[model samples]
Every structure is written in C-alpha cells, then in structure tokens.
Target: MEEPGPVHCLLFAEVTPPLIDSHCHLDAAEFDADRAAVAAAAVAAGLATIVIPAIERANFGAVASVCREFPGCVPAYGIHPMYVDRAEPADLDALRATLAREPAVAVGEIGLDRFVEPRDDGRQAFYFVEQLKIARDLGLPVILHVRRAIDPILKQLRRIGVAGGIAHAFNGSRQQADEFIKLGFVLGFGGAMTYPRAARIRELAATLPLEAIVLETDAPDIPPAWRVGARNAPDQLPRIAAELAALRNLPVADIITATTSNVCRALPRLAH
Candidate 1:
C-alpha cells in the first residue's frame, strides 16, 4: 500500500494553516496581566504569527523581550512620530544599531500623525525622515502608522523610498491606498472594517484587491464592533478576517489564505 504523502496527511487531519496578524502590539501593557494566556489564545484561535512594533527607543527592549518569550511574535523597531518630541538625535543611531543587532522584520510603527494636538511637525519630520533613511539603507521594509497625515507621509515616502512594507491601520482614500500599492506596500485592515458605520473602511475592505490587503488587529486599540469599548487582542483576528470575507463577498478560507500570503509578502522575513 502506498504511504500517504504529507499533503494527504494534512488534508486527512483536517488542519487549516494558521493566519497572520501583520501588526499587533502584543507587548502593550494591556496584555501584561495575562500575556501568555493572550498569546496562547491567539494560537488556539488559529493565528500563526503576530508582528509587534516598538513605538520608541524606550520600548525597544520590551518589544524584543515579547518576541523572545513568544516564538510566534516578531519585532520591529522605530520611533513613533508622537514620541519624536521626547527623542534625542542619538535615538536614531540607537534604532540603526538595534535593527542591526536584532532580527527585526521591519522598521516601523513610524510615521507622521497630524491628529495629535500641539503637533511638532518639524521634529516629527526629522525623526520620520531619518528612520526612513535607515530602512532604505538597510534594505528593509517599513511598518507605517499613518493617521490623518497620509499625504505628508506619501510625500516623504516618495522622497526616500525603502523596500515595500505595510501601511498599518490604514484609513486613507482609495487614491492614497493605490499610491501605497504602487510603492510596493500593502494596506492593513482590521477591527475598523468590522464596523458598519465605518463606511469608507468597509468599502475599501470590500473593493481593494485581495493581493494588496493584509490583516492587523492594532489590538488593545481598534476593537471590532462586537467588542466596542473593550480591549482587543490577537485572538480576535480570525473573526476580523471573517468580517473582511463578508465585506468582500468571498469565502472566509480565501480571505485567510490571501491575507496570510499578503502579509508574508509585505514582511518577507516573516516567511522564514
């Protein structure tokens, strides 16, 4: 009798490969209480991997520790725009060194955020531009935190291009989305798409090409409609992907497959 091949065994076992949460802050204080439980729950919920991005030099070690503690978690290092004011020029040097020392997947959680009050645009621009240069020099992709500053973010991206990465928690126009795609970036959709009232996000989730879309939780932040006013976690990703499937009128399996592939493509190191 012929022995079953590995593919046949997997099929017979009825195992579905796990999904990816392209961007998640698993190191956030919100998970400090039951971080292990949260990671275990995410694995049980079918998540294969989660990307944890550091918001500043201070959190770099925290992010690295989380990734070490959880085999499924990977890290990205950068100085978030909001923290740039508190950042020293030396921080950029630190970021460069950390990226070299650590096996980070991308350079990110970095970008402009005009939504903040008393915005220090100059300081933000300096840090953002410098980090972008670091990413470019290292030939690494970036994970962006673009909010209301999409146009300005795009301008800087154009000025200093890096390897393709993700526009994390993307909430921009179709034109802006297209621009990101043109630059070898994929758009990240998550809890925001689960809300019916988020018409623009829902519309984009429905219409964007599957190949250009990735899924993220932005967890402990953008809770889905069902979890409104509550904490979000990586375990919520499967349902979020299901919501995306509903939006696009596609099978949940298809959404899972395509999005998992999209994220791996966006952050090639994840494929390892």
Candidate 2:
C-alpha cells in the first residue's frame, strides 16, 4: 500500500488578517514625492487599511484626493487642535458643509492639546466643540487628537456627545483609558509603545482589553524605535503590531485579528 500523504495542520496556520493602520497622514508633504509608492508599500506590507486625517481645512481636498487614489486609504476630515490659531469661524461652517457633501469616514484630527505653550485655550475649545457638534449632527464618529488633555477631551465629549471614535496616539492614564472605553472609544497604540522608556504606554498596551485597542502608525511621525529619526509610514504598522504581541505575550496573529476588528468598531463606516 502507498504511504499516506502528509496532513496539513489548520490549527497553527497564520491568521494574517488585513492589518489596519487606523491613523496615518499619508497626504502630508513629506509623502508628496512618492505618495503612490508609499501606498503600494503599505499594501505589500500587509496593511489593508490606512485612515488619513486632515489637519487643516486647506488640506481637506488633498487628503480626500489621496484616499481616492488608494483603495486601502480612508479620509477623515477635521481641523487639528494645533492648527486652531489659523482657523476662522467660517471654516467651521465650511467643515459642516463639506461633511454633508463628502464621504468622510470620521470627523477627526480634532481634540485638545495642553502640551504646547502660548495656545489660545478658548479658540481651541471653540473649534473642538463646534466640530464635535457637527460630528454629532451628522451622526458620525470622531478621530480625536488628544494631547495632555484627556479630562478636558472627555468633558467636551460628554457635552457635545459624538458617536464615539478612536483616541489617536492615546497616552493617558489607566483611569482615562477606562473612561474612553466606557464612552465607546478605542485607544490607538503605535510607535510610542515601541519605545522602551514608554513603560506606562507599554503596560496599557499589554493589559488593556484587546477589544479596546487598535493599531496605528500616525505616519510621517511617531516612527518605531528601529526607524527612529526617520520618516514613518503605514508600512511600519505590522512591526508595531508585532511589538504589541510581544508585550502581551500573545501570538501576532491574535493581535492582527483583534486590532483589525477594533478599528472597524471605532469607525463603523469603515465596515462597508
């Protein structure tokens, strides 16, 4: 009798779900020269989705255009807190009008920032609140750009009431993380967690419920340790995911499945 052929094991097969780069600024000028190449590299590197957020009203068209060129990229429209100084009252109206016309995945790159000095707190609040109201009115989720202001961010969220979104590059305390989760928000983890000195962030990455965490690159910034001092991109997300798996002592496959699904949870429109 002929020997039986070898049997393949499905149990140990790789669970390489499309890795999601929940946040990336692929439309930034740094990528202007090779943007198409960068997008292709992301796909080849296993990144199935990359959410590009606009930082200012002027770039809204540019960001949307970039997303349109890549099947894997999604556009998020909003004025970042850092750019609130240049924002005019009319821009808020423009944002509202734009949201109604565009297929925006979320109102994003929006939130508080206490880290920068000489900022107009009131102006930042105005844009943030107004944008939050727009997001609520449109029944869309937001992509928060929180920095040294989690409590205030949570406060505004409670006041304006958005449809829940991702807290991009979350660097808050455990209590803050819990609050965000309670409000139906998912925390994005990226290059920061790759730093050995970022003990608190790494701990949160390891201990937080997998369902509450999503992977990101925040590209053109937040480069991983190995790529430190270099321009970051969506291609770095898979390695970042591996770092998270190592931190949690879980298989990378599980991290891929959970984080990929987590992004869809935070931005439900992406589900389509």
Give each model a TM-score.
Answer: 0.94, 0.93
lDDT of 1 by residue, 1-272 (tens): 23211111111112375588888989999999999999888878888778889999999999999988887788899999988879999999999989888878899989999999998999999999999999999888999989999999999999998998999988999999999999999999999988889999999999988999999999889999999999999999999989998888899999998987888888877664
lDDT of 2 at 103: 68
Q: Which stretches of candidate 2 lie over 4 Å from their true place?
A: 1-16
lDDT of 1 at 172: 94
lDDT of each: 0.88, 0.87
Candidate 2 residue lDDT tens string, 1-272: 23212211111122267788889999999998999899878877887778888898999999878867876777789999999999998998888777776667789899999999989999999999999998999888999989998999999888778899999999999999999999999999999999999999999999999999999999899999999899998888889999999999999989998898888878877773
Lowest summed lDDT over 10 consecutive residues: which window, candidate 2? Answer: 4-13
Clashes of 2: 0
State candidate 1's TM-score. 0.94
Q: Which candidate is the best by TM-score?
A: 1
Q: How well does candidate 2 match the true structure in TM-score terms?
A: 0.93
Cα error, candidate 1, residue 261 (Å) = 0.6
